[model samples]
Target: MDGEYHPKSEATVSVYDHGFLYGDGVFEGIRAYNGTVFRLKEHIRRLYEGIKVTRINLQLTKEQMTNAIVDTLRKNNLTDAYIRVIVSRGRGNLGLDPRSCPKPSVVIMAEPVAPAHGKEAREKGITAIISGYRRDRVDGTSHELKSLN
Candidate 1:
């Protein structure tokens, strides 16, 4: 069967999915221009790095994942869109145990983005402010890992 053309109902995950359990996962947001996915190599590299750091086992070759992304886009007939690639801890018990979660879930979603005010925003200079909230120190959460807490 052609997985890329399947409906959303056909692409389902178990409720026991560990990503929902322990927030044990990493993801990348990528963009495609024309018909090419940009920075795909970098995105995959970071995903693997996160998996390694989190001790999650994943079996897909990078090429396979890349092809999947492209295939999905092609199936949908979309040339310019955003792609979200996620590798999540697979299904396991209710308890917070990484050992129970042996496999990792890989998902890639592609969709179009509304146009941003590109040059206008840059030329006019967008305004911003530091919110009252302060980000936690990187050391506190091993921010370098780039994985969800």
Candidate 2:
């Protein structure tokens, strides 16, 4: 998961990853339209902000991350697609403390997806339900930060 592109079948991550073990990570959902990534800069900014909130030292800069996303799309030959970027606290011991994790893992995946509700929903809006639960207001776990949690 560390900057390498792999088929969905082959991609894997360590069980010790803080993200997997403790939801210690951040991610951004992005979209590409007509070969152009939409609001990529803004997404990158949000990602960095999340990293800041979580105190994760992502090795890549904002520019590098942006290039990686574009590169992933190009590699997959995807013009219009859904892209998800995840940066996770790397492998560590079973302990809950994050300091045991020395590095972070980065992953960029792109795939095509159709609208869940189909075109009819776009033409005539469908009914919906909203969750009553709200995220807690803790500093490291704030909903605004966007994390694996």
Best by lDDT: 2
Which residue segments of model 1 deviate by more than 4 Å?
1-5, 118-144
TM-score of each: 0.75, 0.81
- Candidate 1's residue-wise lDDT over 4-104, tens digit each? 35565676667787876677888788888777888888877877788888888787877887788888888878788998777888888998878888777
> How does model 2 score by TM-score?
0.81
TM-score result, candidate 1: 0.75
lDDT for 90 in candidate 2 is 85
Off by over 4 Å in 2: 115-143
Global lDDT of each model? Answer: 0.76, 0.88
